[model samples]
Each structure stands twice: as structure tokens, then as C-alpha cells.
Target: MVTYRSAGVDIDKANEFVKFIKEKVKKEFNLEEFGGFASGFPIKGYKKPILFSTTDGVGTKLKVAQAVGVHNTVGIDLVAMNVNDLITTGADPFIFLDYIATGKLDLEVMKQVMEGIIKGCREGEVILAGGETAEMPGFYPEGVYDLAGFCVGLCEEDEVITGKEIKPGDLLLGLPSSGFHSNGYSLIRKVLEMNNVSYEDYVEELGKKVWEVLLVPTRIYVKEIKKLKKNVKIKGIAHITGGGIPENLIRILPEGTKAVVYKKNIPQNPVFSWIQRLGNVEEREMFRTFNMGVGMIVILDKEEFDKARELIPESFYLGEILAGRKEVEIL
Candidate 1:
């Protein structure tokens, strides 16, 4: 008789993985959000409390982690992807759930992934409420896995940063990215393959192995943005991800205002130039496809520019808001 395990699904192994995760969660996460069919988190004491949530996957950046055999940080990327999205809406991250699917259950590999999640939760100051792990043998190749994260953030109705007030003459302040934050890996991989570059190959300009550079997990702006909210009047916040600054910044832009990002003003990260040179990709495509150097953008009135600078002294003056249609011009 055929069994589920024979068909590339392992129920017992999956159960074991769940058991392990339960122990980890109990130890590392805030127990107040623990022990519920649906994780229970209280949202009391906020005036007009609202729930902000986002679900996101790591995309092709997972492939880079697999290529490098570095599984720990992609889980952090998973959490960052969702938590960062929540903060853009001016929400304080409260809880996170993760989904893991793979061909066969590899405890060590998944442990590495979960370790990163714990670290990410700590950094973002969120709880690991609950999650699911699936062993789909036929669906995924052996040694390959994928992760998706769901996050819930709490914010007051009035404080929700919808970017509706963004207008001409506002300043575009850019926060620096550590590296490519878990996006645009499909194009990045293609360039590497076409150029015969392996993860281990050292690029002089980048000063690291190809995969080492690519697997740098996404940065979680939860704590920083939360702090900024208390001290600064954040008109809009854009967590630049898959679409880069042009596509992302435009999302928060008001109908009458546009974003002007000066190319020279951008603190260009080296990996972008390396990839552009290798792929012969145009400047526009580069900005459209990758975050380049800018990670998160904070938009505020020109009058509040110094206030923002006072808070984030190292923030770069990317460009200025302009009177135009709702789009971005990366000059």
C-alpha cells in the first residue's frame, strides 16, 4: 500500500519539526502571545487601534542562500520583508508567523532558518506567535526550501502613515542599505550565470564572495521607524524592496506629487555597479530592478528636513519632492 511518505510527504517528520519549533517558540518569543489556536495579542490602550499586516516571501534571494549553503539569514529576510511592510504603514510590529515548505524535512537546515527568525524577532521586537512547516517531497527538490512570513502590526488610526500629505518641496531622505535586501535575485542570478561567476568567486570591487554579498539578509527598519514615529513627523515611509525606489516611492506619493531621486546623491552601493557592469544593464533598469543603495526612504516637508537630519544625522539627501504626476524621476 502506498503511503503519504512514499509520495514525498512525511507526516511524522513534519510533526517532529513542529514539536521542535514549539519548544523554540516557547523559549524565545513573548509568551503573552503564545498558547492559542490563533495567536492572541492584545491591542489595548491605543487610541483608535488598527491592525496592519503584510505577507511576503524572500524571492530569488533564497536561491543565493541555498547556493551558499547559508540558511540562517533567509528566515530573517522573511521576517524583515513582512515587518518592514507593516512599518511603512506606521504600525508597530507585534507578531509574526512563518511558513516553511520543502521536499524533505531537514532538521539542521531548518534549525538554521529558525535561528535567524528568532534573531529577527529580537531585532524587530516582535513575537513568534505561530507558523507551519510542510514536507512536500514532489513539490520541492531535495535540499531546496522556501519561506513565507506574515506579520501583524498595531497602530492608531490617526497615526497610520498613508503618505497622503506628501507634496511638492518635500525632501526625500534615504537610509543606506547594507547590501541587496532580498530582491531582484532573478536578474542578479542571470548576470552571474552568463558571466560564469560562482558564489565563491571573489570580486575585487565587492571585496567578498558573490553569494556572501547576495545573501546579506534584508534590514528590518521596525525599531528605527518606530522610534522615528515618536520623535519625527513621518509624512511617508517607503521600504524599498523588489521594485526599487522608483516603483516603491511612487506608491506613497500623493496624486499631485512626484519623487525626484538624484543619481549622484544616492550613496551607490558597489554590488549594484558590479552587477550593472557584468550585465550591461542600463541605469534605469538598475534602479527599477534593485534597491541600488537606498533602503528605506523617509519623506517629510522641506521645513522638517533639518528635524529629520537631527534624528538620523547620517541620512542622505536623496532628492526633493516635486509637482508632477504620481511617479518617480531618478535623475
Candidate 2:
């Protein structure tokens, strides 16, 4: 008669891991009267408050983490992806929850992961209110884990920046990404493995190991953009992830307006070019798959372009909004 622990699902270890995380997770909070339920925020000034929420996972990047046996950074990637999406709608992320499922319980690995999560919450100015961890023996291979995050944000109803205000002649500002970000890794892994490329290999252009470039943590733009909100007239914010520029930017465009991205102005990270060449991937496919160096974009009036630039120093003036169908044009 085999028991659950014998079957590779250790309930005792899972419980012990949870007990360890409780203290570390509390470091993400400063409130003395922190409620035991979902997180709560003080809403005093906003006449009409609107809640913003988003849930996201790190995608196939998990494969990279598994390949490298590095787990902490992916946890930060999970939080950044979800909280960054929350801020796109001009929401201030206040609380975050995470879900971790693994084939077996590993306290050491879970502790490292939770540390990254706590770091992300601190950077995004959010509280890690609650989360779940599950150990399923047959669901995943040993040493493999999956992570997802849920975030809730707050904004005044009247102040939500839903692109309704985006108009023709609005300037498009592109924020630089760290690397491939959290998308297109399925193709990346396939291309690398098929070509017998190891993450340890060094590319001259990147001046580092392949996995180092691939693992560069996703940028958290919430803190920077939130500062700009005080004075800038930001019409909309787009978090460019899986769909790349054209698909992601179009989501925030108003019905009558379209976004025109100047391909020349779009910065290309060397890692992307290396991937394209390695796999003989097409240019269009490259644009569709990777962030291509522009991780987040801000749409605002042309007059505010200078101020926007001042706020985000490394950003590029990608293009502008135009009177057209709700589509995006790459000129």
C-alpha cells in the first residue's frame, strides 16, 4: 500500500513550506491591522473608485527556468507581468496573490520563489495578500513548477485611462524592454533545442551567456509611469507581451483611431536578432513573437511628447495615432 508521500506528493513538506513563507511574505506589508482576508485599501479622496484586476502566468519561460534550475526570477516575472497589466488601465496595484503548483513539494525552492515575489510586490508598491500552493504528483515532472499571479488595483472612475481619450495626432512613446520578456519562449526553446544550442553558449553581440539574456527580468514600469500621471496627459498605456507591437497596441486604441508604429524607430535588442538568425525565423514572425525591445507604450497628445520624454528618458517616439479603423499600422 503506497501512501501519498511515497507517491512523490509530500503534504508534510508542502505545509512546512507554507509555514516558512508566512513570515517572509509578511515583510511585504507594513500595516499593523492587516486583515486576514483579501487586501483592503483606504479610499478617501476619489469620488468614484473603479477597481482594476488582471491574472497572468510567465508562459513557457518556465521551461527556461527548469532548464537552468533557477526559480526565483520567474516568480518576479510572474508578479511584474500581472501588476504591469493592472497599471495599463491607470490602476494602482494594491494587492497581489500568487498560485504555485508543483509535482512535489520543495521547501528550499519555494522559499527562493517567495523571496522574488516579495521583492516584486515591494517594487510595485503592492501587498502580497494571499496565495496558494499545491503539490500534485502526476501533474508535473519532478523539479518542475507552474506559477500564476492575480492583482487588484484601484483608480478613480473618472480618472481611468481607457484610450477613449486617445485622438488623432497623439504621440506614441515606446518603453524599452529587458529582453524577450514573458512571451514567445515556446518557439525560442524549440529553436534552441533543434539547433543543439545550449544556454551556456556566449554570443558576441550580447556579451553574455544565452540564458542570461533570456532570463533578464521583465521591467516594472508602474513606479515610473505612476510618477508621470501626476502631471502628464497620458491617454493610454499598452503592455506589449505575447502579441508584440501591432496586436498589443491596438487593444488600447479608440474605435475611430489607429496606431502607426514606425519600424525604424522601434529598438531591436541583439538577442532578438540572434534568435531570428539562429532559427531562420521570418521578420514578421519575429515581430509577432518577441517584444523586440519595446515592452510598454504610452499614447498621449503630441503636445505632451516632450514631457513624456522627460519622464521616460530611454523611451523612443515610435509613431502616432491616426484617423482610421481600430487597427495598427507598422510603417
What are the TM-scores, per candidate, against the unseen true structure?
Answer: 0.95, 0.94
Clashes by residue pair, model 2: none
Q: Write the per-residue lDDT of candidate 1 for residues 165-247, one digit (tens) a residue.
A: 88788898888887889888999999989999888998888788888888888888776787678877889999998889988
lDDT of 1 at 52: 84
For candidate 1, the 10 contiguous residues with the lowest summed lDDT are 29-38
Model 2 agreement with the true structure over 1-331: per-residue lDDT tens digits = 9998898878888778766666676554864443355555676667788988999999989888778877778888988999889999888998899999999877888888888888888888888888889888888888989999999988987778988898998999999998888999999999999999898898788899888888887888888889778878789999999889878998888899988889889777788889999999998888888888898999888888998788778988999898988999887
- Residue 52 CA displacement from its true place in model 2, Å: 1.1
* Candidate 2 local Cα displacement, residue 285, angstroms: 1.1
Give the poorly placed runs of model 1, Cα more than 4 Å off.
Answer: 1-7, 32-36
Off by over 4 Å in 2: 1-4, 31-45
Top model number, TM-score: 1
Task: Tell me the lDDT of candidate 1.
Answer: 0.86
